[model samples]
Target: MKTRTSKTIGVAASAAAIALSVPLAVTAYAQPSDSDAPAAEIPDPQGPECGAFKEALPNWKGLADLPVSAALASIPEISTFNSAISGGMNPAVNITSVLDNGPYVVFAPTNEAFAELPPEQAAYLRTDAAGLTNLVYYHAFLGLLGPDDVKGQRPTQEGTEVEVTGKGGDIQVNATAKVTCGGIQAQNARIYIVDQVLDPAEAPAPITPTSTSATTSVTPTTTAPATTTAAPTATTEPAPAEAGAAEAPAG
Candidate 1:
């Protein structure tokens, strides 16, 4: 009877050990490995000028189906540029139509940039049709150019060239204006928003002195001494005649 009791106790202990081991095995199998877990997604960093716009348009991939003019018009920051093109300020150049068909790269200046312009220049552009058209054309290029592709001088629709240079994360146009936002895509163009308005015609010509302005020679003037005439003495004349007569008599 004691042996039977000892056997039953051994069986019960074995069953408990097996039950505990089965739970541990199941827990181990259910846990996920590090490699099997999904990776966390990271977002790309935006340019300083585009950061706010990016946040505003979180779903914008690219305006690839829209025309260049329409794409620029959609962005509120570049409203000044949109208005210039579509406002009919330049009847001769149809800027809006030109942009509609382009495989062009456009450097758009912001409303603040226009406001920062010398008030006279901004006013002049608003009224002068041809001048405004040329100004707008100066900012456009024939083909699509991203930040990486923008280097050296590129010709614009206005028949002028814009000097492009890039260093680190910054891009400069015409050696003065910096590209604040870049690589914006449209159906037929790439757009870069610049901090300043680029005017090829308004760029000051290199200072060169004319041939007539050679070294100036100063001629010094000589002043003659004042002549003083002594009061004629009747005695002096009498003295000359007397002296001649005396000499003749002495000889």
Candidate 2:
């Protein structure tokens, strides 16, 4: 009986010791040195350009009101351009080539802005490479201009100039278009959010020469009436004047 009781007591004590040890082992494992654990990874929030502009200026109305000039100039990649102006500007479909440092001003329409243009103009932009390139240059100016800097008149890269004005508490540039909000300063760049997309200057209509037969007919008809009326009136007036003078002398 004594041996059985001792065996039972030993078993109970061993079980209690095991239960307590399991909790301690788990606690030690959980509290391992920080060097033994994996490091937390920080996510990148901004785009490829590793600037803090987006983070610093979270409230800025970026490119929402502006034409597509700044983004087109700054980011050369067409894919980035498409992504940047995805909202209302659809230049992605039409624009195959882009220019930044050329001697031309480009108002670069956004994907949405380009869509808003007439089908003919949009088609021309897509198919006509030389024309599109020239048009882009037409909107560019020599100096870097921000929203604040572009008030009043600005000369384009082309000889022609565009006027800038402020209205309704918004700054309006040429084409009577308004820039709602802007003034984002990037490295060696500035962005303005304009209200309307810019349009390329329209080509002048060709002058067609009149047909030779039509020209001859019009010229004779135009001269005949004046010649006939003038000669007859002059001769009759001289005779009447001489007769009146003779009658007065006799009286």
Candidate 3:
């Protein structure tokens, strides 16, 4: 009996130990290990060109005091545009004077945008005075327009209107060019960074055709009166011949 009781106690203790160890084993397995933890997200590194561009922009406090032309001159991203305006690419346009004079909204294209242009067109614009002048003027609007004012049709300095449309928070000009960075303020005007260059040749000129049509209509009217007078003379002469025939028959 004594041996049996000792054996029963040993079995109970063994069972209890297993129950405690099973819970501890499960707890140890459930806890996450260092290797199982989520990895930290790596940040995207800035490109060299982008870094240089950011460094070239004026500091926040000083930007407001600078004129639009000066502000544009300070940014490396738009250096191509600034150079075109200042370097006499278009002799007729005084871009510096225009930017200094008033409240204009300039849609400045990035250097990348210029580089993306077709080689032939880019070459022509680099040397063609009229084309360059028209191209620059097409991007400049007369008054200051913020992002909110950018919607709808707006007249450009080139004497033509461009269509501005906003959809899902994206703004597009002429349904082709898009505004990348907008509402940048300067002392004389606002500057919006655009992805593409605005071409004046693409804008519609309805007035020219309408004027031509008016001129063509007047030309036909002037010629019609002369034709009518000649027709009457021919009829009069034929009547006289018919009278002469009647006189001949009587004789």
Best-performing candidate as measured by TM-score: 1
- Candidate 3: minimum summed lDDT over ten consecutive residues — where? 215-224
- List, residue by residue over 93-184, the lDDT tens digit for candidate 3: 45777777878878788899999999999889877878888788888877766666666556677777677677323677778987776666
**Residue clash pairs of candidate 1:** none
Residue-wise lDDT of candidate 2 within 1-251, one digit each (tens)?
A: 99999999999999999888785544344677889889543222222222433444453344333334444443322222333233222344333233333322234333445456688876675666565545544445544455444554444544345565653235655545554433443323344444355543532222223555332112121224444444544334343455446454564
* lDDT score for candidate 2 against the true structure: 0.43
Model 1 — TM-score against the truth?
0.59
Task: Report the number of clashing residue pairs per model.
Answer: 0, 18, 0
Clashes of 3: 0
Candidate with better TM-score, 2 vs 3:
3
- The TM-scores of all predictions, comma-separated, are 0.59, 0.39, 0.57
TM-score of candidate 3 against the unseen true structure: 0.57
Q: Report clash pairs, candidate 3.
A: none
Best by lDDT: 1
